[model samples]
Every structure is written in C-alpha cells, then in structure tokens.
Target chain A: MADTESLLTTPLDSLHRSLGARMVPFAGYAMPVQYPAGILAEHLHTRAQAGLFDVSHMGQAEILGDGAAAALERVTPADVQGLKPGRQRYGLLTTEAGGIFDDFMVANLGDRLFLVANASRKAEDFALIAAALPAGVTLQPLPDRALLALQGPGAAAALGGLAPALTALSFMGVAAAEIAGVPVLASRSGYTGEDGWEISCPAEQAETLAKTLLAQPGVAPAGLGARDSLRLEAGLCLYGSDIDETTSPVEAALIWTLGKRRRMAWDFPGAERVREELANGPQRLRVGLKPEGRQPARGHTPIHAPGGAQIGEITSGGFGPSLGGPMAMGYVAREHAADGTALELLVRGKPLPARVAPMPFIPHRYAR
Target chain B: MSELRFTKDHEWVRADGDAATIGITDHAQNALGDVVFVELPEVGREVTAGEAIAVVESVKAASDVYAPIAGTITEVNSALTEDPGLINREPTGEGWFFKIEPKDPAEIAALLDDAAYAAFVESLA
Candidate 1:
C-alpha cells in the first residue's frame, strides 16, 4: 500500500496503463496485477490458450571472466561447473545454514553465463554472489535489459513462425536468436508449468516485442494475478512466501536442483548440513493440499490433526480456476506428508477438511 | 418492486412488509471482482443488524457479507451454490444472498435510500 509516486516503471508501463491494467506496486516496481478481463478469465485463458507477461522487473545479469561457473559453485549447490553451453538450469543460493536465500535461473550463453534472479531479492542475491566470486570472476547486473514470458499451449504456434530455430529448443533450453528482426535470448522455460518461453531483450525494444507478441493469434496480455495463480497450480515456489532464508532446499522439496556431482563433492556453501539432511531427510517437508470444499484456506492457516494438534501451516492457498476447486501448498511433519493423508485447515477458527495431494494439481504440459 | 435500503458496508435490502431480501450492492460486487464462491447463513437462523452473516469468495480474496438489518433467515438462493459469477452478472436480482423475516419492518426507512446510497458511493471516490 505504499505511494505509487516512489515506484519504478518498466518499459511496458505506458502500454500496460493504456490497456486498462490495474497497476500495483510489486518489488518496488509499479506493475500490473490484472487487466480488465479480470484474474479468473485471465487464468483460464492462459491454460487453454496463450498469455503474455511483462517480467521486466526481474534482475538480469552476467557472470564473466575465467572459471565463472566454478566460482558460482562456491555459493550455490547447482552443477554450474558442468553446465553445457546454450543450456539453462534452475538453482538456489543458500545461506551458511543450508537455507535458501533465493531461487534463480542461469543460462550458459556460450561465452558468458546469463543469470536471472527474483525481482525483490536481486540486490541481496547479487551482493552475496559477488562477495563469493573468486579473483577472476565478476557479476555485472544488466540494467539496460527487459524480460518477458510468453506462456501456454498456443504460445509455440504463435511464435514459431518468427523463429523456426525455436521449435527445436526443448524445455530449459536456451538460444540466442533473432525474432522478427530483434536480437533476443529466448529460453524455453517459465514459472508456469506450461510449455513456454522467456525472452530477454534490450529495454528500448521491449514494448515493440511485447506488442508483436500480443498481436499473435490466441495470445492475450495477462498480468501478475494470473501469473501467481498459474505458478501456484504448477506447485512452483514463490520466493518469500513458499521458501525463504529459514527454509532449506531439502525441506522445501528442491533436492532435485542439487546435481549428483555437487552432492558427491559436498563442497558448496552449507554443504555439510545439506548433505546430512539429504541422507537423513529433514524433519518437515513442503507438500500440496486439496481442501475438501469450495472455500479457500488462505496463507497462514494452521494445519491440525483430527483431535487438534498444530502440525504445520499453509504457505500459499487459493482457488485454482482451471481445477474448479481450492488448492493449497504448505509444510507439514514428514510423517504427514504422504499423499491421501487426512488433515484439517483452520479457516476463521473453523476446521475445514483437507487432504495431502500430489502437486502440479494440474499436470505440467511443458515440452519434453 | 419493494422499497430498497442500503447499509454502510454496501449491502442492500428490499423490505416488503415482514419479509425482506438482502444482497451486496452493485458497487460491492464490482469491487470484489469475479466471485467464485458464496457461503450463506443457515435458514431459520436468527441474526442481528450489522452482524457478519455470509461470505463471498473472489479470485483475489474472501470478504464477509454483513447483515443489513435484524431478521430471521427464511430462504437462501440456491442458484449461487453452483455458479457464484451471478453476483458479478446480476448482483441485485439473481444474486440475492438470502431472504428473511424482519423483526421490525420500520427499520427499513432508517437505512439509506437509493439516492442517498448513490451519493455515499460517490463520496468514496
């Protein structure tokens, strides 16, 4: 609820306003929360067709110098050292205690490593990463760039005409290509579980590229409201809400991000503790929840056993528009993390029946 | 049409002798945005004016719907149970939350009239 006067504006600011988007301050930027179509319609539209998003607020940077990937490995547990060129990997920056500081995507652009971190945590993540860099490596923030995501089932068909090379790219693949005469680094990856692409380009060319994408058939402009719901249904973690400095990667069900080589070396930050947890398992685990009714049990709702023992708490909860029911994700005791286990959510002091369900509540449709 | 009255919380009530029907105003539904679920009080339940009597859930958040006047619940709208979007479509007609038997029919005049409610909504902007 801070004053909009102090907020930063992205390259698509005027375009968003002209399209009747409801602008809200997010991560210090005046961003659109929803358009005139509303959140529900925007959400369902993205699942069935295609949705365009202006993600220019996210931080873009490059890791340069000799042994850049090896230097990054000091702070993150991902296999940055062995990452193939033109490939992208999802990773986490961990605290000394093995707690995740931020989640990021790193694309090996052949010559330099292209890194993208969360909007709010970019500053902190960069500072931590910079301090951990060895003598030859340097992190340069890309302040002159902009980011956008084109997502859904119809996204490929809409964009494939401009760049035929895009059709060959697999999920998590990255390539530097020219789309409609604009040079861009298009990564076949997105926060939503749908098959999609996130394009990084110069700030000056952002509005032009976005306009071109929106003109494509079946592609409509979507905002952060639909983006949040889409990612939640995909069971993707929102940095501050779902995972934070107090939650370790293992506890948050992100062990898949730790490469086999990284685990064997056990030399990254908080490696001792992370290795111990990897072998023995964490005391608590993050799991998906399906509330047994139409009523949504929102974040901070307490989870209780049948007789009423506080076991865990809901971190992210809302109505999944595509599924036509309320869904939630939370952390509970490992023993209670099994799918189909009975649980209850305390909503307005009333116990609402819920069950532990498998995630990506709607199965991911990402390209293999 | 029965005489309509409004509450400060944006609920509107139409009172016809002892029976009254209640629902959130058009302004209320527009502000809430895309209602997905509605939970109303049980029929025959007694309620006081200004008490939280029902819940309206939207894609953005859940809001409590307060009773406009003291009454005993009579009938609830069953159409909203399957499709809550009616609140966004026809908030004053098909979207009526529930009906009740007023404890005192005279209380209806004390609430805001149509003109007064329009002025109140304008003042908020």
Candidate 2:
C-alpha cells in the first residue's frame, strides 16, 4: 500500500467523507470501502433496491481514428470490429503467452470506441494499447471524467426517473444522454449482476450527479466493500484477486468473451495458448466453492481433494451477504471442477469440508 | 457482577471469583463490523496471557481474539457458532466467548479498568 498522503482523491472524495465513509487506499486512490451502513446492509440494500458507487478511480478512455476496432483486436481476443454502435462488449487484453493482461468493458459510441479498465492496471493498459496502435490510430485517456455505477433491481427505476430515454436501453446497450441535465455516457450493464447503468460524466459534475442520483427514491450510497461482495456473489471475477497475468481466459472460465470469430481467426496475442487450451482443455479451471460451515476460506487458501494431494488454491473467497453463507471461487484441477464435486479447503491449517458449486450463487437480475 | 477489566488488544475480562467471563470490547466489535463467524477455544485448554485464544470473522476479514490473562478454559460459548452477530449486538453481555478458571486472579488487577479502557479507546482515534 502506498502512503496515505500520496494517494489520489476521487471527485467524490469529500462527498464520501461527508457521508461518513471509511476511506481506504485502493489502487492508489483514497476510496470508500464502506459507509455507516456497513458491507452487509449495503449489499442487501443493493439486492433489494439500488446502490450508487463511485468508480471514478477506474480509467476511462477512447480510441480514435479509422480502423480503431481492428487495431484493438491485435491485443485483445474480443471481436471489437463486430461490436455495433449503441452497444458494449466485455474484452480481455491478453499477454503474448495467452494470460490475461486485463479485463475491461469496451463500448462503441458511434464516433469512437470507449473503454473502462481496472484502476490498478489503467496506466499499464493505456500504455500497452497506445504502443500497439497503428500509425493512424490514437488512444485518448479521459482523466477529466468520473464514472458511477447505479446497480440493482430498483436502479433502472431511479435512473429512469431522471432520463426516461435510458430505460429503453437493454443489457449491454450504451447510449449518450443527458442525465439530470448533465451530458453523460451510460451503459445498461454492471458488475453486480443486476439491472443498472454505468454512467460517465465530466469530473466537475460528479458530486452534483451523485447527490442527484442519491436523492432518487431507493438509491443509497454504497462503497467498495459492498461492490466487491456483490460481484463475488454474481460470480464475476475481480482482476487482481481472481484473474491476473498468469490466468488465461480458458482457465478463468471466460471462454464466452473470446469472440467466436477471433477464436477462428487465431490472430490475437497469445492465440496459440488459447487455441491449445480450447482444443485440449485447460489443466486447471476456475470454479465456485461453497463451504459447508460458516467460516470463509479466504484467498490463497490451499485446496485439496478428500484425503488426497493438493490440487489448486482459492483465489477469492468471502462471506456472500446475499447467500447468507460463505462462498468462494478458486482454481481447481479440471477433474474436480464439476458442480457438486466434494473437496476440502485448508483454512487456518484445518481442512474444511466444501464442494464445487455453480457460480452466481444467486440468480442474476440483469435487464436483458 | 464484578467490574470488567480490559486489555490493550480490546478484550474484556469479567472476573467472578476464580472464574472469568471473556469477550471482546464494544470498541473492538465496532471496529470489526458484522461478525459472521466465531471460532471458540476448546474447553480445558490452557492459555497464556496475550495468546490468541479465539478467532472472530467479519465480512471483510478475520481477527484473532487474544487472552487478557492466563487461564484454563472451563466453558465455551456455543451460541456464537449459530449467531456470531451477538458480538456486535451485545459485545459485553450475551456475546461472551468463554469462561476460564484463572491461574492467578491477581493478574486481572494489572489490566485496564472501565474508565481507563474507555480513555485508551479514545486515544486510538
């Protein structure tokens, strides 16, 4: 962790403080981990209603010039050129060896391709993308913008109250609209596996916009703690915790994000490893785990077969507030990745009974 | 009921004759929000002062509950296995983690009293 004094503050930093948030250093930014409501309440609130999150720490940028989508395809396995305007797609930048560089959301906003990358990897992601670009293409970093995610069952209703036109967008749909009289780009998608919008606006208008969203019925402030638990429950992967430079798309169970055409073309970086894994099957696979007991098996906990050798290790594990129990996701040998395959999680030197379970412990409520 | 004594680690010990009821202080519970699991020490196990005797888990992370004074565990709280939130709801009462028969009751006097513990908690902020 970096020194607190040297950490950057988001546009909503003062607002988070005013809301009684517990500020923590995350990805070199002073972000709120939770507020007075705590993680459990905030998580339940989002499930039942809506949560407003300050995701301004994430990097937002645009790709400009002709053949931008094709240029992006050189690095990522996603079918960027096939993405139509007014829509978005999840993409992964792959290392030469097929490991994931970073996972990001790329939206076609008609004139240019918009991207949102993880905060920790933004600098690296931008530089990598910029260096890979053709002489005619350009990468534009949007440092003057702030992003917010309004997510939950009630999210659409609350945001719809401000800009009714946004309600028309389906899941993964992107549109440019004036939300609360502020020009913004919003997508009908979120990491929480809920019906919501990821809205991007000018940095200066972020506070007013956040307050406006909070003023809407059933919308309350949530912090990174809730956001993390929510995503975990949704079976989504956290970049640093679940997937990293060494985890390939196949092993991470992100085969769907590997565009069909790209797989056929086999032209992206690290294509050989992905192709080999696709045909021969990955040695280890990311799977969900449900501990029979209440104690959570946190990240790095060794995983083993019953009365057998160590197979893999837990990547991310914690209490899933929605499930009202402990849930986890980890990589295990392909033989033990099936749902209901009994396993043991070595927690605190004790082997705890657990079983491989299907992900999205709770059903997703995305507005598709 | 005897007045509660405290340790700098935020554990409280309520001494009653040779037996003492132990639990985390309210300040500690507030710091560790939304307790989800409590791993209690086994009865009859001998513990030394400042030793980690139990584990308390919240949604975010797990913390060790240290022994305030040396003692032998006489009984453990079984209710916490089912409802760990008792630690947050009643840190000093129903949330008691265990009862220990002290090796030396006089050791309780060296721990912080209520007012001193309160001041110590304030200084942390």
Strongest candidate by lDDT: 2
lDDT of 2 at A210: 96
Highest DockQ model number = 2
lDDT of 1 by residue, A6-106 (tens): 99999999999999998999999999999999899899989999999999999999999999998899889999978899899999998888899999999
DockQ of each candidate's interface versus the true one? Answer: 0.67, 0.83
Give candidate 1 regions above 4 Å deviation. none
Scored by lDDT, model 2 comes in at 0.94
Candidate 2, TM-score of its B chain: 0.97
In candidate 2 the C-alpha lDDT for residue A202 amounts to 99
Candidate 2 has a DockQ of 0.83
**Model 2: which docking level applies?**
high
Report RMSD (Å) for each prediction in the order shown.
1.6, 1.1
B51-101 in candidate 2: lDDT tens per residue?
998999999999999988888999999999989999999999999999989
